[model samples]
Target: MARAGLTLERLTLEGAELVDEVGTDQACVRRFGVKVASLYLHVKNSQELKTGTAPLALEELADRAADALAGWAGKDALTAFADA
Candidate 1:
């Protein structure tokens, strides 16, 4: 039900930035310059947007952890993961 110019990926990225700026409490559809009705075409609501964005952030974190720990061992890997 997404609009022609909008997609879930774009909404998720924008939602993530909104969450960063004002925390989840203030990341509303208006922040993305879209009508509430239009927003609902892509996401059921603000909570759904946040839900979709969460896994993207987690995946990015995991990738960074993997890269940071690539060839390190033991304490070094632990330190790298922690630092990442």
Candidate 2:
């Protein structure tokens, strides 16, 4: 069953973390659910799920980098972005 407050965006974020924890080749819907079918409702398929995570990861990383770079610029922003 879907979590009490789960949303597509949240699921994508979690999936991205799962990929980082595991490896992209091993991060499938079954990694998050008992059955592949269970993930159909959340993602179209394994390929789509992985595709979803890519943009989500990029957006999340960018946001964190931006937050870390707040009130900074140039070299500081570069450091923050690199650290993120």
Best by TM-score: 1
Q: Model 1 RMSD to the real structure?
A: 2.9
Task: List where candidate 2 sits over 4 angstroms from the true fold.
Answer: 1-14, 25-44
User: What is residue 41's positional error in candidate 1, in angstroms?
Assistant: 3.8
Predicted structure 2, TM vs. truth = 0.59
State the lDDT of candidate 2 residue by residue for 1-84, as single tens digits.
Answer: 753554666667777888888776245455555355655666666677678788877887889988998888899888877887
Per-residue lDDT tens digits for candidate 1, residues 42-83, read 777777787888897898899999999999999999999999
- Which candidate achieves the best lDDT against the true structure? 1
Worst 10-residue lDDT window, candidate 2: 25-34
Query: Cα lDDT for residue 35, model 1?
Result: 70
Clash number for model 2?
0
Name the 10 consecutive residues with the lowest summed lDDT in model 1.
25-34
